[model samples]
Target: MTARVLLVTSEAVPLVKTGGLADVITALAQALRQQGVDATVMMPGYPAAIENACNLKQAGNLPELPGGPGTILHGVMPGSDVPVVLLKTERFDQRTANPYVDENGAEFDDNALCFGSLAHAAVSICAGETDLPVPHVVHANDWHAGLVPALLRMKGITGVGTLLTIHNLAFQGNFAMSAAADLAIPDSMLTPDQFEFWGKMSFLKAGILYADRISTVSRSYANEILTPRFGHGFDGLLGARREALVAIPNGVDTGAWDPASDRLTVRHFSLNDMRGKSGCKRDLQQLFGLPVDPFAPVLAIGSRITHQKMADVAIDALPGVLERFPRAQLIVLGRGDHAYEQAFLGMAERFPGRVAIHIGYDERRAHALHAGADMLLHGTRFEPFGLTPLYSMRYGTIPIASRVGGMIDSIVDAGLQGTIPDDASGILFDGEQAQDMVAAISRAFELYARPNEWHLMQRNAMSADFSWSGPAEQYIGVYREIAPVEAQALFDERSAAVNDSVNLPADEEAAEAAAMPEYMTA
Candidate 1:
């Protein structure tokens, strides 16, 4: 029988997005539904997330929320077979654009409470406490919905297993324990085995401790999180669940990401018709205001400018890279840490015409940049599963990335090893040092200097299958394996309570961040 899965995420496609998490949620939900694995996507009504809502239904109402009484808003996904729910609170109003924000462009302190409530609503749906159907399983994505696994268990609901997918371990949400009551979770549940983290309430820990099974975005990431280096202070906790941890590398929706079919790119090309790719290079150059020279190697980046992304390595190697390859040009997209922003802006100013910077997220520009660039830059400190590298490969762009997490998994196409195989995608830098990056880029540069060699690498990248079908199937296996008849009644009861909650929309912030597409960043 098909597993009825309730997928909970902070963001999803066509509604809102700020990173690969949303894409993963959208892809998995759609793919599962296609496979007859019934699925629904529950997301916060963050302003950007609700912008595309075609219609809404009052799911039900909740008596008291963290801020006050709240209402539940439900809407169906545009083209997919998934239902999305938005939690609106009477006191604070639900966020309309940014899920994590207030009027002054700052994150709300009640973010934990806000998102926690949304998770409760999903659980309520599963327990049949709401008007919606009781799901066989609740699939929680990332740290945002980490509270789901624990909240369901806290309500004494069982049988409907909770599968928590950790996209990135570095983002665990740890807040004051005082918020536990607001979350409708008892202080006793905050013990070391539960949601506690050194006297703080940890949402991520809640998932780790309570979920029936734990999964990460990549196998390497799942293994990495067991060590002190990648565990983010939760290695011990993860060690406890050593037997329960699983790795399912994320996959892209091939149809949406295909270079041959994507109209956003300047040139439409496949492995056989690569000549059109040069047009993309010219388009990229033109868009970035750089010299449109087919001979120059265009190095591109489309990620948040943060230390986590190892963007500093790119900044540090800029002078050397420019001196070594005079024809080299860089175009960066996305926003992040203030320090990195200042540094990138300074570099752009210092090297006019050679460096182009777009400070915020723009999905179309990101797609164009991925298609047009000759080589992609992904020097991250650590990655759960870097989706951009896969996106680049799909567009026939060779990648130069750090050997970590999903970057390693996605960049290295299986069975093509050593001696620049015809299917060799890109160069891998092992260390975080600037010299290492400079050397790797230098190697890519050497390859770029040779037209035939560069074309072979591009072909290698394009042939990879980063599609969601396989991963979706894997998720289905995990969902079914963990689902049992025992949890059915509990799930139904919880669903009803959640459906009975309130949802209030947040007022438009006067100083909201630029309303560019939020999906393609980070």
Candidate 2:
């Protein structure tokens, strides 16, 4: 009686990953299975995914798409038992490099055709055109899979509910209206009420219009998108479907992110004994070629270098921070926005050993930074749901973040009155100016001078739970709301049993955590 769900996404961790979306899809699917739901992941067969898959077998051939027929391959996700379906076609097979962009950082020219075929195949499978079981719900993530819901409705496929999750509204999949014929979208469905957005065909708009439900990554983000400031021109459309919109904050894989067991770090440590953190600090300083001064506060940046991420603000605030704390060092790791990249490189050059910059991403280095650094610097203008801050907090590294997006939901600012009775995880500052970040850094330095208070804050951060159990329960509730009566009863019974087995703290901390945000807790 369990409702079957097909998680349609463009990327998934271990197989392919471009951002946090990959991690969310993989972890959420696994969490759903633990909650007694039958979940499967469906994605295009990029070269990396095909190469990494084990026990792969040909499932069947899909119905003719705009480009040609696609062959479906079945395999299990590398580290888990979750089943995965890989759509194999000429277009997807040709994408040997990055899934969405080319070496030059430009989106592939045939992106519309590439993703359109994925959606068409999803609809065909759900409509009984394939040999696979029909999913009770088709859960699509981001613009890459946005066309699934629209195609489902256009084909008049019944009994299949669609849930579209908007990870970031800024990257809407927009293409010229003339490409509709190439994408095989019917002309009748091209009105402003459907896929049309300001005379252009918007794949994201189609999903928002046709999906049975829509979700954002965080509660504050869900509310922010309803206004003109954060909607990116889709505010009015999303406002019309306000009732269907919900927020399910992203969660961290505690097992994979635990500081006690993480193999990526040089030394393992926990709240019980933080001596290993000093060893990790020395290792990080050695790795980055900075002075191995354990007392010098290490501030790390592990986010993409982009304007929205406020990488410029982080860079601009460094000089003032260095002037105040002469021994402070900064280590930056991530790649994006050539301008920001050059700016960071320039900073590293200007301040020989104190500043270190890595132009690209390395999973091991990121984990090391989170475990080794004293504080994580995140100055984002707008973020849907950032996973790095959560990861950092779990490692007992305090976050110095801007007061926006998921940062507001996740980090409990020490300065915020009445937020927590005796604990604070991080520091928060408002505005997008460099001066704002400098002030926040100044406050962080002042707190760092008091080891007792700083260690107490670290304990609070390490004790915080950002696991998937709560988010999985929330998602199950959404599924039950759209599922049949029999399925609803089955879900309710399973959920009750699951909730009973979970042991949450029975003190004021639990109550305060629960009251923080709807998406942060059950």
Candidate 3:
């Protein structure tokens, strides 16, 4: 029997996005379609999502949903033929700033109920209560859709495999135990071993305990979340269910990101012919009111200015980078954490034309920033997968990033131990200190001065295959594992496929370091 999967997410590209998760979901669904898996994305009907989706129509309704009532609208995702199902209700329609956050940058007060409605809606599709495909697998992404597996179990639904993909373990959808009854989660399932996390009910924890299998964005991150330093607080629980864990690395949305064809970039460029790059660089400089100098190194930083992204550390080290590389120019895009925003604003004022900062996220600027920059500064305390770095690499822009999580897998650090110079794609530093960041930035400038080596590195980065084809196939394997296929054709046909998704628990030393946290919601 052919495999059918329902991909439950909070966002997607061209419709809405807060980060890389949207791009990953869109790419995965498109790739899965190419490989014969009947993948359908289910997300909330934010105003943009509804407007961007093609051929939209009412699919069904969930009247007594967690948040009162919700209508499931079926349509094709923006810019793709992959089927999309969106939850339409007042809970999602009223708030427009961020899907999960309000205008004040605070997470939606009723997020538990909001996403709870999303999870319940997925169950409606799976249980054949709606006029949609009865999926063989329900693949829930991040903490937002974390309750899918638990809701399936609670409703006594069988023959449906559940897979939870942890995009970022830190943002676990944790809320008060008092709210458990509202979502219909039972007290028996709210114990420490189940969904209870530090006297709270964690949506992520519920999925980890009940899902047929669990997956993270990358192999390195899969292992990282198994420890205390990176686990946030769920490492011990994840370790206990270690046998169910797997790693599927995220892939780039090559169609939207390629510099040669991207509609957002000022000038198109390719690996063989990089002549247009200077024009794009000039446009970038002029866009920020800086001198249009072709010789100056333009370093781009595009990410949310949050503690997890080392925004605090960047505030301290960026001034030193400006002083050390007087001719270098910096362009930053993304918004988060007010203090860091103010700090960058102050730095821009002090440096005048040399430093420029864009306070919020914009698709056009994001594409231009990568296409024009010589190098990208991406220092994350922990990364599920380095989508920004990978996107920059596709544009022939090298990255100076932290040596953690997915960055370890994606970036080939120059002059670092266990790395070959000819294959080095970017610069990587291990420490979190400002000095370490400056050291990495310093090394990038040194590499930039050598034209031949820098060009070679850029070519290597541009040529690297970060597509979704490989990872999507691995996801198919995951679906086939617990899915009740009527025929043996799936196994017989895919016998040649590599079976490398397994990730056994790390040793005791690694397990001791496992932990999780709730940064939002009390």
Question: Best candidate, lDDT-wise?
Answer: 3
Stronger candidate by lDDT (1 vs 3): 3
Q: Candidate 2 — which residues are off by over 4 angstroms?
A: 416-421, 484-486, 493-522
Clashes of each: 40, 0, 12
The CA lDDT at 318 in model 1 is 71
Please give the range of 10 consecutive residues that has the lowest summed lDDT in model 1.
495-504
* Candidate order (lDDT): 3, 2, 1
Candidate 2's residue-wise lDDT over 428-474, tens digit each? 88888889888888777788878877888899999988999888888
Question: Model 1, which residues run further than 4 Å from truth?
Answer: 90-97, 101-106, 413-418, 486-522
* Model number with the top TM-score: 3
What's the distance in Å from true for residue 329, model 1?
A: 0.7
lDDT of 3 by residue, 373-392 (tens): 99999998899898999999
Q: State the local distance difference test value for candidate 1.
A: 0.77
Candidate 2 residue pairs in backbone clash: none
